[model samples]
Target: MSLNDASCTFESMTSPTTLKTSTEPPLVSAVHWTRAQWLLLMVVCTVLALDGLDVSMVGVALPSIGQELNLGTDSLQWIVSAYVLGYGSLLLLGGRLADLLGRRRIFLIALSVFAAASLLGGLVDDPAILIATRFIKGLAAAFTAPTGFSIITTNFAEGRERNKALSIFTTFGASGFSLGLVVGGLMTSLSWRWTFLVSVPIAVVVVFLGMKFIPKDKPSAENSGHDIWGAVTLALGMLGLVYTLVSAPEQGWGSVATIAGFAVSIAVLAAFAVIENKVKHPLIRFSILKEGWVARANLSAVGLFGSYLSFQFIVTMYLQSVLGWTPLGMALALLPAGLLVATSAPFADRLIEKFGATQLILTGLTALGLGYVLFLRVGTTPNYVLDILPSVVLLGIGFALAFPSINVQATAGIKDSEQGLAAGLIQTSTQVGAALVLAVTTALVSGHGQAAGTVSAQAMLEQYRPGLILSAAVAIAALLVAAAPSRRRVRT
Candidate 1:
């Protein structure tokens, strides 16, 4: 829910030297970076930032989309969910592909996929085709995101250098989301199509630079065939569940269609567990989850990101439909939050050292929960200074502290070879959480019994309140997870 635009994981490369399962990394941060290493980092970071930009811009673009396409609330919701559905479902598989195939290959291939999708998306006339393009873009991002992280972790030594690289990476990633809010707004003023079209150039430039400067990866000798059945079942299952949630408002929770969809999804996901346990080259090692940090960190990520994105979705809607602001005005209003995220993400490492991951995670969730609560104060009339600014500032502060810590917690004990898997799992948690929770909350807003009958500004406020309350509740749950007492602990 946290990303209106938020996310990534996976890769591609070929070489005679077989990539090994050795726990050692290829590059060490202890050594000074070559000009080449710095360039690689910058390019990869830019690509990651692009993903965030896509998300933020799209959030603002949604209102324009609805007006142009003459879409109802549910169709508008699908525009976002389509992307989340594809991205969340494939993340784990994408991560494994990176490890088996090669990070560089997957990275390059995924970037190309993303650019091509964006180009087509901008040209589409039908909402269905546009939704399809969003899904395709998400699939490409699922591969690119984790692969980029793997590239960084595998290259940098643990400790100051790795930490520093990650901090800088988080900064750029946040920058994309923040900047995208503004850029999308400005571009949307020209036409909403520009939002989808704009990423084309950025992705193309990044791929071109990547081909030259990004080092080639050795193919894994351990390259086993992918878990076809597991991937298929998981994808279908997640899609079904999301569809059920999205349709529940209309279909009724106890309706035959809703029940059947939920039933099938559960059965399929259970089957996926069976296949993972039995397979020799399981898509993911179930045992890795035995580590408490890995499992809990991922669960917390789901809640944290879910609430964040869901909140953004509602806020953007309120800005355009209720307050009657243009997309550019909405972007400038949110510019502070983005600025806060950029300024604060760099210092998160220092905060981690001082307060530790657990405390910081707790603090971040608390800030986020409070921000949503503040947002509930908005009415038919607007007061940006008091009502919205506080929420954005708090949300920004919360994300800066939590996002990087969540990553550190998820991947800390993972082996260098398995870093991609760890990255994929957590990223999956982020996307799936966003996809599912967003659907559920959106249904809550538009669902049959709960909100107002009309789609007017006052009616939307009534609908939006319930969703914001849900967002706050989700954040509280994440905070509780962070604060939970546990016998097992991993490095924060």
Candidate 2:
């Protein structure tokens, strides 16, 4: 069959069996889907879901993890920061490898590694080992997450079909992250280790299904010419920058270690830019960076994600520490945000198609900024209905609108071969932004703490307000950036 005919047949075959028309020929009749496709999709969804859960779940279990591990406030930050460091640093490399190698192979291998790391983390008794395992898991996640997108990109032809599939994938990812809080809360009530252990079964199922159904792509001949030096420089530079941010709270900004780290990051990143400009096959092409929409979308992501991460971290702490809510209660309280994120995202695609990404992104930022302002007005008195819920709903709506629009805009007009690279850049910016904001906000709040007896609940709340307010201002800045004429349209 011709390519178009083959695709048409495949589309009709993949459609719901119940919808088959009576006039359709017997051979063209929709065959019952084998166990493979269902299992494979489930497995991939599980992997994405676990990623979502792990990111949010830790917040719920942080208090317990700290108590059991005998960790201080700074160490608590390290636990999360270490993971982001590993994940963010390797994201681009992961995407590159998926394109260079094969998405199926990389995904399965990464999933296996992630599973093993999760197991080690769950079983480890020592705090140091736990942190190390978390880092390993993050590294594995860096490999797996982008590959999920790559798989969809390769398997589904672009247009309405690809858009719908991607939408479902993105929605599941969002849901996974939000639901993870609920799962983590429940699991932590039993034992903090359960949070890590939960991944074991899901990973097994995903790996098994993935092997059965995920299509294998032949290695690209062009991939052999990858710029290894560019990859190394980029990773190291990001690592240095993230380390400096995460460590600055404890080491002090002026300390030699922090200063050295920042200096090295700047120098290394500059070197990376220079190398990319000269190299024939750079890890990230300089040409792509010159694209206005791609650059602005990524820059906006840095600010948008940074604010969101910082807000969530602070709110989780406030609910548990100040309000004295259990993990379960806190999870329940945050459910609206999670549901909103999942429900609103599909509609965002339609909005983008009608009004374009620029307007949707701007509106999202406005909603997010307003949400933060509303959250800042929240007092020590626990009034969840009036103070917290409104902000949660608004923030949910904002992120739901923002995330997919940014993804679509960033990838629009890019060549098929470059899609993986663009996807990696987007994911890396998000995690790095989270790490940056968390570090800065933590340092600011920790530094503002009152004398031991004077540290009332309200005083603690007041200290956190500055971080939230700063986050709001950052969102406003993102709105401004999104509104700029340079980013007003995706260049074809």
Encode model 2's per-residue lDDT on 31-58: one tens digit a residue: 2334654455566667877888888887
- Using TM-score as the measure, the top candidate is 2
Q: Please report, as a residue range, the 10-residue window in candidate 1 with the lowest summed lDDT.
A: 7-16
Candidate 2 local lDDT, residue 139: 88
TM-score of each: 0.87, 0.89
Give candidate 2's whole-model lDDT. Answer: 0.76
lDDT of 1 by residue, 1-492 (tens): 232101101000011022222353433223367898888899889988988888888877887899998998668767776777677767887887898889999999999999999999999889999999998988898899889888888887654556667767866877798779899888888899999999899899999999988888875556566678877886777667766765666677788998998899899989989998987777777878866368878988999889988887788778887888877888888888788778875576555544445666777888989998888888988678988899989988888878877776677656777888888988888887876677677677666223345667787678678888999999999988777665443322
